[model samples]
Target: MRETLGAEDPSLEVTDLDAATAAPGDLSTLASPSLFGEPRLIRVGGVERLSEAFLNEALRYVESPADGATVVLRHAGGVRGKKLLDAVRGGAGGGIEVPCAEVKRDADRSAFASGEFRAAGRRVAPGALRVLVSAFQGDLAELASACQQLIADTTGDIRESTVQTYYAGRMETDAFAVADAALAGRAGEALVLLRHAIDSGADPVPIVAALAMKLRSMAKVLDAKGPAARIASEHGMAPWQIDRARRDAQGWETAGIGRAIVFAAETDERVKGAARDPEYAVERLVRFIAARGGAG
Candidate 1:
């Protein structure tokens, strides 16, 4: 969400629905241009708890999304505005839905954790990672946080005992978080999350998958001569995805993007057991992508 917001308009007004005096009418402010004609990002949090008036405003505004105004309505899911959500999701209203679904199964939670570490260029044994996930259970965010803490406190391979000692009762992280940090070239931060994730039991395959998706988006649009929307349409991706890829791909040359694709393929093989150490393979992949270069 932050990535999309930053890409569209860095200068935005953040208004929580609970705090806003005119929650419904605030949509109008976004639709109308500023006196100085500056573009804006108008983010409204807590759409799930929106009052009747606020819901109405959202429905009406979504009918014709404001030009040059990014109105981000965050819905955490519920019964209050099911119709409105359906309308928006059905594309009766424009904009995309980035779902943050809850992780239910142990396998899924483990996969999530592994992806986190793989993205950050870290390695942890599969057994250790599963133990970490069991410790966190239902709190994915905390699991990811624990991954970062683990990386900060330890070095080299993260072991099962490490997960037992530090994150038995606490810790957290996510794959998207990993990709964001990596693409932004913040290797240290990414690695911290990566270790935490692997420790918590995220699967390396999904981590590789995330990197592949990001690189594929970057490759599809790189040097493609057209409007972003048109290019995205040609590539069968959402405009926002293209927009995000463009922003994340900044400072990356065409060759770098290509090389990342190759690394992504190799990592896929390694994570699937082409190598003895899937953890090491993923770590290498993360390092290469984060560097935006091929192996020297």
Candidate 2:
């Protein structure tokens, strides 16, 4: 809720209930006119940890709140916490809940990314938005921070390549991106990002494992002949993602994907200890996959 509100109003007052110096009675005292007779806007925050006495006082105040006071309560969504939340919900009349869950949907992530860039007085291209979503792992806070960092580090419109370059270490160049590049027939770009992942400290073994997972997904989609929607629903994948996999699956038979998965497993084992130069082993695996795709 704070994040959403902060996006609109930068003058939001945030107070930690654990560190609040005043009690509910303090609201009345604070809102009282000073020697100069000037009016003030009082907004009490952090009622989640209010003491029993303070809670009663606060509840009473909310029952008939002062004429121009706004009280915002932040509570964890729990059965015990629901009492205070219900009080505010039943009385105070306005509030919003900010669930502490990571944003995973592409649309939500894109909106968050776009909002962050726009807030900083910059524009991001559509392709760049997808790149940001892919790289940032759908963490809204991290995406927001990345946008701010980019705004501070560079000038003008931020591009996809720029985001990739500046956020190489911060971003996860995981096998998902590698699979995306390879399945799209951008083997050169796939190899480049694979190297970037190695340079950025991702172990070759896990990279191989990620590749194997991608191959397995393709194989699953290939084997399923039911409705794409039903297949995607069963597999917990977006329809569009499943659609892309279906298109990519056309180029590879189930046996071919099985071979790729086996290759990935072998590469994973080799990278752990068998292969002297793990980088070379990974490159060979990538080349073999690309060649197989080309052959198909």
Candidate 3:
């Protein structure tokens, strides 16, 4: 909004108000015509903790606002500001309602990263957006900062390789470690690591991706009848990765890999908000994968 509103104008002044202690007079000066005829932008933050006097003053200010000043009322959305909110909502003048909802889905975080890039006049590829979202999941601020930094530092479009270069193997290794634990038939250990990764602010989508990637690699090599180098090249994996997948697939028949893949897919859906408890869903996936390995 500041960008669109021409914040660079020398005549524009900004004021921050703590609504709890701010009186009507304090707010009145903000909306009043500046003696020097400058425009004012007043931001009244924490309206949810507003005092009666503050609310009354805001209401009064709403009745007759100054032409040269713009007043912005901020709230954290709670019951404490019910009266003030209702009054503003019911006002004849009407106000712009900007709703900032929490981001819960993988797609949401991706869209957020895309928006940040778009706002900075940069184009980002879908793969890069996904990588950025996964790298900074559950933390919008960090994601936004990274996006802006890329915008300021780089020119033109951003690709998945660029994002990979920026974050530098952030949480992907941890996510893969969880997948390794589950695939090695250590369900109990996998659960503990999964919990630790999640509680440490790891994104569930990437964790699920790591598992799927591991299983897919295993399935590929398990069904192959060629040299490790040729098979690894065909599957777009490193020779070492193929060798590791071969080792991990030791106890599994082709049937077990298929069943594990199915369970992993089911858990993927469950973790993406389909289940009541995503952590529980992941736990079940690990256990099922491990059990399938043992059965094979």
Give TM-scores for every candidate, taking all chains together and pairing residue i with residue i. 0.43, 0.51, 0.43
Candidate with top lDDT is 3
After superposing candidate 2, which stretches have Cα over 4 Å from the reference? Answer: 3-10, 13-130, 137-144, 147-159, 169-171, 174-181, 184-202, 223-231, 293-296
RMSD in order of candidates: 16.3, 8.5, 10.5
lDDT of 3 by residue, 1-296 (tens): 53545455656776778888887589997778878888788877778789888887777777777787777787876898777777777762365567778666554666667788876678988657655765675446557678878887888899878876877557774586688788888888888888888888877777887888778889988877877878766765545556777888888888888987887898899889898888777777777777764432
Which one is best on TM-score? 2
The residue ranges of model 3 lying beyond 4 angstroms of the native Cα positions read 1-169, 293-296
Angstrom error of the Cα, residue 153, model 1: value is 35
Residue-wise C-alpha lDDT for candidate 1, range 165-232, written one tens digit per residue: 77543322255556667877877887887777788788777777777777888887777777877876
lDDT: worst 10-residue window of model 1? 12-21
Per-candidate local distance difference test: 0.70, 0.64, 0.75
The model with the greater lDDT, 1 or 3, is: 3
Q: Cα lDDT of model 2 overall?
A: 0.64
Ranking by TM-score: 2, 3, 1
